[model samples]
Target chain A: MAFRLIHASDLHLGRRFANIPQPPDGNIRGRLMEARHASISRIAKVAHDRNAKHILLAGDTFDTATPSDSVVRQALTAMGENADIHWWLLPGNHDNLKDAEPLWETITRDAPANVHALADASAVELAPKIFLFPCPVAFRSSGRDLTANLMDIPATKGALRIGLAHGGVVDLPTAVLTFRPTETVAPGSIILRLATGTDVSKSAIAHIIAAAPNRIGSSMDGAVSA
Target chain B: MTLEGPGAPPTVEEVETGAFLWINTELPLLPNTDCARALEAVLPDEGRRDILIRVRATGWASLQQQADLRQAAARLGPDFAHFDFDTNMLGTTYDDADLDDIDKAGALRLAANRLKEGTESETLSAEERAVSAGALARLYAYVKEAAE
Candidate 1:
C-alpha cells in the first residue's frame, strides 16, 4: 500500500496587509485576511477529497512568531474540525523555535488531537514504513545548514524516509586566503596569499594576477612559476 | 495561619490550601525547609498569589528558558512583557524593563544590548553563549521586520 500526504506551506495566518494600499470603496485587507483563514478549509477539503490523511505543512504557518490568540485559536479550531486529517506543522524562519517558543507551547497545550507540531529534529512515522525527518528551524536565520544531520539519522530497514526542511539555498562560493610571509614586504610590495580549502586552482590565481599585473608584484610570477 | 518568623515553614492549613512557596537551598536553611513564611510576609495584598523567585540558574536549560521568555516578551504583547531577574547577576532591578512602554524598535534595542553584554562577559559558559547567539539572530530578524 502507498502512503498519501498533502504538502503545504506558508499559510501565514494573521498576516496584516499593512504594505498593500487599501481601496476607498472595498475592504481588500479584510478579504485577504479572511482568505488566509479560508485556505485552511480548502486545503482540508482537498485532503479529504484526495484521501490524504496526513497534511504536512513544511513551515511558516503563522505570519508572525507571536500571532494573536484569536488567530492561533481560530486556526487550530479550523484544523481541529477535520478530525480525520492529521496536520503536521513545522516551524519555519518566520516562526522559529527561539522566537516562537510560546506559540508552539500554546499549540502543544491546546491544539486538537489530530494536529502535531514538529518542534524537534526527530524521525516521526507517518505510516507503517514511511518516516518524516523534520528539520525545524531553531533561529530565524541560522547561518549553518539545518538539515546537515538528516543523513546520519537512524531509520528502519527499507523504510521510506522523507526529509522536510525550509530555508534559502545559499550558492555563494567562499574561500579562505592565508598570507605566506616568507620575505619582508616594503610599503608598495604586493603580498601573495594562497587560497586554502577551496576549489580555486593555482591557474585561477595566476589568471587573477595576470588580470591585474601592475598591482601584483613581480615576486608572485616567480612563485607561480615555481 | 500562625507564623513563627520570617524563615519558618508553613503550617498544615496553609499547605492544605494551594500555597506555593519557593526557597533557595543555597541559603542558610535546614534540609527540606519551605519558604512560605518569607513569601507570605512579602505579600502586598490578599489578591496576589504569584511570587517571582530570582534564582541564579546557571544550567543551559535554564538560560534557554530565560532567552525564550525574553524573546516572547519582546515579540508577544503586554501580557508577557514582565519577567523576574536576579539583581546580583544582572546588576539591575528585581524586575525586567517594562517592554510595554517602549515601541518595537526600542524593545529590539534592549534585546540587542542584552546580547552584547552577554557576549562581552567572560564568565558566561559555552551553553550560555550559544543561547545568546540564538537570541542575537532573532534580534536581527526583528530589526529586519521593522525595516520592512
Candidate 2:
C-alpha cells in the first residue's frame, strides 16, 4: 500500500500585490490575485489526478495574517468540494500563529471536515502506521530551530514518520529545493528554503511517493517544498 | 477559603470543602473589614459555594499603589484558602466602550510599550514572556503603519 501525498507551500491566498506595479491595460493585478485562489483548485485537481489522498501544505497558506473573510470562506469551500482529499494547513512566517490569532480561530471554527490546521507542535496520525510531526510557527521568526525536536518525538513501532514544517533550511539560498518523497534522505535532513514575497505564487510542488514497507527510519522524512 | 489567580478554583473534590473566593491580584486595595464583611454576607447564600471578585485596574499603578495592594493582600491572607502574593500582571480593566480614536490609539501605544518592556523583564515567567513576544509581533505591523 503506497502512502502518496502532495506537498505544497506558500500559496499566499488573498495577497493584494501592492508592491508590483500594475500595467495599465491588462488587469494583470486582478489575474494575479485570482491565480492565488485558482492555485488551490489546481492543487486539488493534481491531487485527484495523482490519486493522493492527503495534501501536506508545508506553511504560509495565506499571504497575510489577516486575509479577507471571502478568501478564507471560498478557500474552505474549494477544499470542501473535494471531500476525499485531506488538506493539512500549516502556519508559516507570513501567516504565523501569533499575528494570525483571529485568522486561525476562524479557520478552526469554520474549516470543513477535510481541512486540518496544523496549529501546534504535536504528532498527528496521517494514516494507519503513518504519522506526521508538525512544527507550527508561533511567531514570524525565532532564534532556535523549530524542527529540532522532531527526533525526540516517539511514534508507533515501525511507523513511517514524516516531518511537516515551513521555514528556511540553514545554508540553503535557493528559491526551491526538490526532493523525491519516497526515497529516504539521510537522518536529520533539512529541506526547503523560506518562501519570500512575490516568489511565493510561483512556488514549486514536491510530490511525496511513499511505497509500502519503507520505514522513514529514526528521523522524520524531510519536508517537501512546493 | 480564599483563592488567587485566574480561572476557576479547584472543585470541592480537588480541595477542602469550603466557600471559594477567587481574587484578581491587580484589584485596587479594599479595607480588610470591608472584604471580611463582603465574605460574611456571601456566606449565607446556601446554594452558591464559589464567589468571584474582580477588582479591575484602570492603568499601571504607581509604587505607592503597588505597596498598598501588597499590604492589602497580606491583611487578607488569613481569609483565603490559598493566598498568593506573587502578582500575575496579565489582567487589564480598560473598557473600550466610550473611547474615541485618539484615546484608543493612545491606549494601544501604551499597551505596545508595556508588552515590549514585559518581553525583556526577568521577573516574567517563560509562558508570560512567550505571550509578550507574540503580542509584540502582532502589534509591529500596525505600529509601523502608524509611523509611516
Candidate of highest lDDT: 2
In model 1, residue pairs whose N, Cα or C atoms come closer than 3 Å (at least 3 residues apart or on different chains), thus clashing, are: none
- A19-125 per-residue lDDT for model 2 (tens digits): 43444654534655675677678778877876778877778788899999999999989888999999999898889999998988888889999998889977787
Candidate 1 ranges beyond 4 A from true positions: A169-226, B1-148
lDDT of 1 by residue, B1-148 (tens): 1112212221211011111121221111122223233222332332222221222322222222333334543432121111132212321111123222123357556776687567556899966875775566455545445655
What lDDT is reached at residue A26 by model 2? Answer: 40
Best by TM-score: 2
What is the per-residue lDDT of model 1 for residues A1-226, given as tens digits with 9 covering 90 to 100?
5456665566678878565345476464565567668778877876787677987776778879999999999999999998999999989888999999999999889999999999998778777756777889899988886655654454344455556665432331221121111112211111211111122233211101110000112222111110
Q: Write candidate 2's Cα lDDT for B28-144 as tens digits.
A: 323222433333343323322222223333334322233345455556543432233433442322223211211246777577667757766899997897688556544553444
> How high is the lDDT of residue A108 in model 2?
84
Instruction: Report the lDDT of model 1 for residue A194.
Output: 14
Q: How many residue pairs clash in each candidate?
A: 0, 3
